[model samples]
Target chain A: MTFVLGIDGGGTSCRAALATADGAILGRAKAGAANIRSDLTGARTNIVEAARQAFLAAGEDPDLIPQTPAVLGLAGANVGTYKQQLEAILPFSRSSVETDAEIALEGAVGSGDGAMAILGTGTAYMVRKNGKSRPIGGWGFQVGDQGSGARIGRDLLEQTLLAYDGVREPSPLTAEMMGVFRNNPQDVVEFTTNAKPGDFGGFAPKVFDYAAKGDAVATWIVDKAVADVEASLGVLGLEAGDPLCLLGGLAPLYAPRLSERHRALLKTPLDDALGGAVRMAVRMFAAPVEAAR
Target chain B: MTFVLGIDGGGTSCRAALATADGAILGRAKAGAANIRSDLTGARTNIVEAARQAFLAAGEDPDLIPQTPAVLGLAGANVGTYKQQLEAILPFSRSSVETDAEIALEGAVGSGDGAMAILGTGTAYMVRKNGKSRPIGGWGFQVGDQGSGARIGRDLLEQTLLAYDGVREPSPLTAEMMGVFRNNPQDVVEFTTNAKPGDFGGFAPKVFDYAAKGDAVATWIVDKAVADVEASLGVLGLEAGDPLCLLGGLAPLYAPRLSERHRALLKTPLDDALGGAVRMAVRMFAAPVEAAR
Candidate 1:
């Protein structure tokens, strides 16, 4: 019997699912990172490995893989001409590629119209209206991704330094953050000299934790972050009737802190990114009744 | 016949001055970057090479180097144990090392008690009062260094991305910045993935130029940057009697934009950093009358 394959490839990891044409999932598998920008060779390898694992887990004939149709929602696909290149080389009989945000929107809304904001180590905003989708942020950490966990963590570090300089009042949160770098502003400075977004993101949970405990500085940072999220949602024009889902690691932390206006429209995703890819696969390859007969 | 050496080492370049015990500069020389944090080996080599150049320029006997005292005002000397390490290996009879800001302060204020803010690719504020000195900010781009050129340029890129997303109105400056990255937010993202503070700083001049032309976004950014500078000065507690000087690459651009309160306190530098270093060298090795006899 024929089946379809769905893959969600991201910076940190890749996941694959094997499903029937009716959208019933058969098997799922996961592999290492597939960030097409930094490690194209590694990403291509991981994507195929994930698909192979999914096929094996489904207990399908190995020969059937050559004929399986696949759809991939991948990071780094939005920027370059590599999508067609990756498609041309895949083992599947047919394949299509879309951005990770598009698949996330598909999985969250399930063919419906809505918006989703991912608030993890990075940030990306997507709005799907009347079958067309537009992305707002997710430009990456340096230039965009405002109010993301990485940005929040960076802000925390900055506040810690300000407190060190006596420019700002020291708080328990800032003290603790400085303590991690040995209570030495110099060490903190050294650490940041070569820091990446994920490295900075390591402090995000502390911000949320301190905010929960009513730490004034932490509360201020969280408030600013939530305000940035609201601004993106406003730019996306989230209406009273529109559903908005928050996704990614920091989403849950930010959920309760969001304003009542957003809380009212906030939604839980119906399916995950892999499920969305599976649905996309079905859309791409589900046979007509006459063809099936 | 005795001579003194003064060296000013920074991330970009190193300068040296050879002067008499009375602090009359005899010669000056320059060398490549000498930041201790990122390039310890290079810093050591550059420091010695600069001293050699100064000595040669001054027509001093190279063989008398071991008897000639030296003072260094070096960047990256603030945070590490390298000061003692560097001192232990110098070729001079006596060598003293201080932070670059300290030298700049020495250079800017001479023997007087006062304050100065260096607003270049990074920012640092120093106040010397009654034989004591204190520093504020200059923690580096990832943490502090607010109102710095690097921070300003990064802010420009961020605003450009915001305009691209339609979250903010696009201005000519932001448009030009995006144009540099080929109008691709992804391209901008990719460029920042590996950009250093200096790379970001390269765009700061554009921000100032646009602000001069009354570009709304550029004006807003410049105003906010100047405000941050003012806040830092306030934190430094510039007294009515205190002499303040603005130094560094962006200082001239920011000098006119400063609030009247700051402009009123601002004064001209007494000398360059090398002059400060030479004065310091004289102080470090001024012979007692008994020793002189």
Candidate 2:
């Protein structure tokens, strides 16, 4: 009857799964953003609330959250003091914090040797070999995060400005983007003044859609993004036929555009990162608790 | 003699010169940044402080500030409410505010038809014809500022990251930049998190210096910047042999690199923007206030 919890937290929302100690799925729940680095207190509150909601969804007592062991896969936990800070404040009987990418690697390939690149609003690459995680470029939107949705969208805006200034030939894509800002470069400038990475990422789907329709500017942007991803994969030492997963929102779009060698390495993930967190919780705390008997 | 004041206010500091009813310079003084858009209150305080200091430097009473007619050329005044806000409360008998570029145009080519390009931490363009000032692309670092020092320095960082990731071939320029951040991409990433445009602008000199020594990467970056500046000038409808002045801190570096068409238009500024402001003050307010009437 022992219970465990797995949590996947991102910049927008958090998801939690209630499971048996042996990793049987019970129920799932979702809550608000749990971006630890930006809003630790808010993340803590939402994580606990998600766990409570998960228990209730499983037709169990919300009170059981205190007894359940947990493994949390969270955005922003990998790079800063947020990991230690989160670990110390978690409500579970026993808990551990791992990067959203680390758990993604576990779910995408396995607990063994493999690699995964999560390309959503931002990008992060993780390689797990001999059970050690080697991370590359998740440096947020201000710098790093090449091939990310935000980066692609930002490139679109920069190109749009160039086209507006007649420095570059305008395409339908730039024309459409300018239209979104009411055909005013000043409006575009004002929008970027306070734009988060996610705000910029909102334009990424348009870039991809336009590229599919053979728009020249869109094609150019996508071509560069694909090359950047390929280079990052190459730099991460991803070999031919090594298990790799293109994870996150942009995964499906980027997966096909990658080179044949990289395409050959792509494998369907067994489960999403939430499942991986539950599996980890089962292995780390549940098994130890069981072994004591 | 009725005293007048000319003030040049920028993001870094404010400079003021005291003069007689005419445009002759007396003594000059400086204070902290008077960037009104970012810091309205601070700019107001510093503007008055610089004016007071100018009076003191000219061996006049600091209280003479209230009697002095003033014209200020200020950064961040053109695109926002800062100009109007500044005028409503300036501690002078009469005051007027204009764009730093406008005053620079006045200084470089006088009150006649002319154009000026300012290349510094950020870039701005002003074309004064038919007694009206036309400004283009002073839209801050997050968006516009195409040929700016900040943009050049930021390009260097992006190229350095690409080189580090093996996406681009490495060179001595990239090597030197990475060395500055202790050869760790993470260190470079962290530095950019809080870096101001000027902080990034700090690295622009190395880019120009390396271009002189034939660094391929530096040359590529500089060439692109030159093209952008050229394109902007063309967009501004700059004609052959039109009175144009290239102003600001990076002007000397960018001067020789520009196209011959642009070079032919380049003329040495008659005086700095501060002098332009003083000349304006003498014209606008000093003539009316003068006892010679």
lDDT of 2 by residue, B1-293 (tens): 37889999988899999998877788899999998888888999999999888888888898878877888998757665778888998888888998787778888888778788889988878887678877777777876788798989888988898787676899999999889988878788888888999998998988999999999899988998888788778777777667888888999999998888888888899888888998888878866656566
Per-residue alpha-carbon lDDT of candidate 1 for residues A42-65, written as tens digits (9 for 90 to 100): 888998889999988888765787
Candidate 1 CAPRI category:
high
Clashing residue pairs for model 2 = none
Per-residue CA lDDT of candidate 1, range B148-214, in tens? 9999999999999999999889999988888898888888888888888899989999999999999
Q: Which ten residues in a row have the lowest lDDT in candidate 1 chain B?
A: B284-293
- Report the TM-score of candidate 1, chain A only: 0.92
> Each model's TM-score, in the order given?
0.95, 0.80
Instruction: Tell me, by lDDT, which candidate is best.
Output: 1
Error of 1 at A138 (Å): 0.4
Give lDDT tens digits, candidate 2, residues A184-290: 78788889888888898999999999999999999999999998888888877766667998888999999889998889998988889999998888877888767
